[model samples]
Target: MPVATFSLVALDCPDPEALAGFYAGLLGGEVQKYNDIWCDLRTPDGIRIGFQRAPGLRPPSWPRADDNAQQLHLDLTVSDMEAAQERALALGARPLDLDDDGGERNFRVYADPAGHPFCLCRT
Candidate 1:
């Protein structure tokens, strides 16, 4: 058997509360602030994403394996790619790659407010 079960994914950023709020807005989650250095978003699907304060953090330069690589990313599935893109942009997610072959591809990439890369995949 496995030695451990899945747990939350914690991200290091400058502002934990703000990062948690961003994810909360995008993922329909409840934001819980534990302290000045830590916050988390408990999603409707019971996925807990924690955000911790890391001052002077350098967010990854996504799509570039050299230099500062994309350490990690979150893939979110949606039914309407267009609608999801709209919402994500409105909520401060910068588009990294939206050229999905005119909707032929299954996923598109974006960078969060903290510059963390994430994808909005079509279901």
Candidate 2:
């Protein structure tokens, strides 16, 4: 038996609305703002992601194992890697790992506007 069912993943960032918008654009979601400091996005695929205001928040560092390690990352499945990469970049996702063993890998890494790392996985 499961101890708890999944609810949502909340991220701490300097601007909640901006982060929410970023994800909403990529994930095809409706963004709701509770206040200047809080925002929630319910993706079209039915995943809920929350963004909370954190003054002086430091975004996570990717491909790292130090104190600034990547604490969490979202994996999004896609059909066309090139098109998805272009869309993600257009939506403010910065490439973290473009060289995935010269296309041998099944995923690519990127950092969201808030600097959290995520992957666009090939389906």
Worst lDDT 10-window in candidate 1:
61-70
Tell me the tens digit of each residue's lDDT in model 1 across 33-98: 989999989999999999999999889997879778889999999998989999999998999998
lDDT of 2 by residue, 1-123 (tens): 989999999999988999899988888879999999899999987899999999987889889778888899999999899999999999899999988787799999999988999999998
Cα TM-score of candidate 2: 0.94
The residue pairs in collision within model 2 are none
Candidate 1 collision pairs: none
Against the unseen true structure, what C-alpha lDDT does each candidate score?
A: 0.92, 0.91
Off by over 4 Å in 2: none
Candidate RMSDs in Å, in order, are: 0.8, 1.1
Model 1 score (lDDT): 0.92
Q: TM-scores of all models? A: 0.97, 0.94
TM-score between model 1 and native: 0.97
